[model samples]
Structure formats: structure tokens, C-alpha cells
Target: MRQTRFHGRVEGAAACCSVPGCSEPGEFRAPVTPSSFDGPGSFRWLCLDHVRQFNSAYNFFAGMTPDEIEAAQSPTAGWERQTRAFASNGGDPMPSWGDFSDPLDAISARFRPTAKRQAVERFSGAERHALGVLGLKDDTDLHSVRRRYSDLVRRYHPDRNGGDRRHEKKLGQVIEAWQTLKIARAFA
Candidate 1:
């Protein structure tokens, strides 16, 4: 039972061909030194016919500079300005906190007005038709429209319906619906 086809080789590697009378088995790697004072770069291996004669005389821009080999053969290689596209709502076009007083807090401020004053005097289409002619609603107030216009003027007062002058035209329409709810409470 023997099988052997070491493709890009390195299997259980204790490699050997650091090229001294090569006993073969080094499975290929290469650069043992170019410039690593003492850390990350070290590899020699080389046995597939001296790693194909050291990758046919490897010279990756060897001693660079013809404008560094035309800026390393740039098709925008390493893209000059680091290959654009970042602006998702660009930035720093200036406004980086020019006195960002917690969003212009104009000094210990307190602006409470997102619609109030009794919700703009309880919705006004003529104070909602004078709180529907005093049967009151729009959150009634002016002292509950003077207590529902004095209880509809004592229930259509004509001597309380005894001296009944036919409810005196319903007590002059409850005194003209309490003078249009006291002139719509001075404009609601």
C-alpha cells in the first residue's frame, strides 16, 4: 500500500534542500533573506529543481525606481488616492461642533410650546361654534361657560315657567347663547 504524489509539497515538512548537496525533499518555499533584521521573514526550502531555478531568477521590481517602476505598474495600483468611494453623507465639510451648545441651547433655555395654551384654546372654528351653543364641550371652561350659562338661564326663565310667557322664546335663546359664549371667550 504505497501512494505518493506530493503536489505543492510541504507535507509533514522538516524540509531539506537549503541547497547544500541537496538530498531533495525540501518542497519549495524561497526568500530566506532580503531585509528582516530578526523577525518575520525567513524561508529557504527549494527542491523542485532548485524551485525552478529560483522562479526563473525572480526580480519583483528588484531595485525599483523609474518612478518606482511606473508606480508599480499602476492601473491605479494601490489606487493613488486610496481608491475613493467613502462618502455616505460625506464628512467634515466643516460643521464639526462650532459651539454645539447642545443644539444651540441659547443659555439654560426652556421653550415649552409645541402647541398648548389649552390646545390653542380648545380648537377654534369660532370656538367650535361657541362650544356648540353652550351645551358645552371643547373642554369647556370659562367657568364651564358660566355654569352652562346659569343652567340655561334657570331653564328658560319666565318666572321659571310658571309666569310662563311661553318660556319667553326659550329665554331669548338662553340670552343669545350667553352672548356667543362671552364672545367666544375673547377669541378662545
Candidate 2:
């Protein structure tokens, strides 16, 4: 028995080119890959010449403004900003989004970077402690700090913690801590 080399379908809508009576087996897979944000994924069935023409005329960034184009084309800017290594606590810089014993408290504490009127007061100082907890040295490079921060943020993010409203505040605090540290560290 001979095995068929092509496992793809060549019948019905997938069978022929949409170009009138062209009876060639649609050789190319033209599935449109959509953005992860779920915009659109409509595939086109075209013959070689038509496919080439479509490719030539297609402008993926058609509707965007000049500013949008410029911004999107530029390297990500916020990654280089300072964080909290200058807190005078003598601890290492905090991981980007370090883990916490309580996520609800973390999220709630984000709003209070200053010293008063908040459950987790002195978040700037707490941020310094988080860096110490992560075991990063005060002199650690930005690259290492960001990498560790990303790791902890992913682990404790409230969104990924399965609908625990309690964790939401904590997650926010964790984020705030990282942001404070990142900005302070960047400038200092």
C-alpha cells in the first residue's frame, strides 16, 4: 500500500482556488495568524499570483498614526528607569515584582508609597526589604534585577492566582513595590 504524502485537505472550500474555475489543488496554507489579543484570523484561499499580489499590497500597519508607528518602532523605554536601591537600608535592590506572604495587602499597599494613611505604610521602605528578601546585592546590575522581578511577578500575580479577590490587593502592592524600586534604582 502507498502512503499519501500530503495530509492536508483538497476538497470543498479548501479544495480549489477561489479564482473562478481554477481546479489546482490549493497548495499553500494561508491561515492568518492573529494577534494574541484576539483581533482576527480569517484565512485567504488564493492561487500563486493572487497570493503574491495580496502579499505585495498588504500593509499590516495600515491604520496606525505616525506617532503610533514611531512609538511602536522605538525600543521599550520604561525598562531603563530607576528603582529603589538607594533606600539607605543597606539591603540589595528588590526583585522587580518580588513575592509576598499576602497578596491582598500587597495590592492594597500600592497606592501608599508615602509614610502614612495606609495599611502597608512606607512602601518605599518595604520595597527595599523585598529586594533584600530576593537576596540580590545592592550592586546588582539592572538586567539581573529585572529578570528576578519578572520571575516573582509572574509567580504571585493576582490574575494568575485563580479569582482570589484577597490576592488582588497584594498583587497591587507587589507591583507598586517593584515600580518604586525600579524608578528609584534607575535614577539613583
- lDDT of each residue in 1-188, candidate 1, tens digit only: 75466467676567788888989778767877765666768778878788888889998998997898988897877755656677856422322232222444422222433242122233446556656766677656677788887887898787877877877776676677667667653434
lDDT of 2 by residue, 139-181 (tens): 5655776787787677677667775566566556666656757
Best by TM-score: 2
Instruction: Quote the lDDT for 181 in model 2.
Output: 70
Write down the TM-score for model 2: 0.30
The C-alpha stretches of model 2 lying farther than 4 A from their native spots are 1-14, 31-40, 77-188
Q: Model 1 compared with the native: what TM-score?
A: 0.23
Cα TM-score per model? 0.23, 0.30
Clashing pairs in 1: none
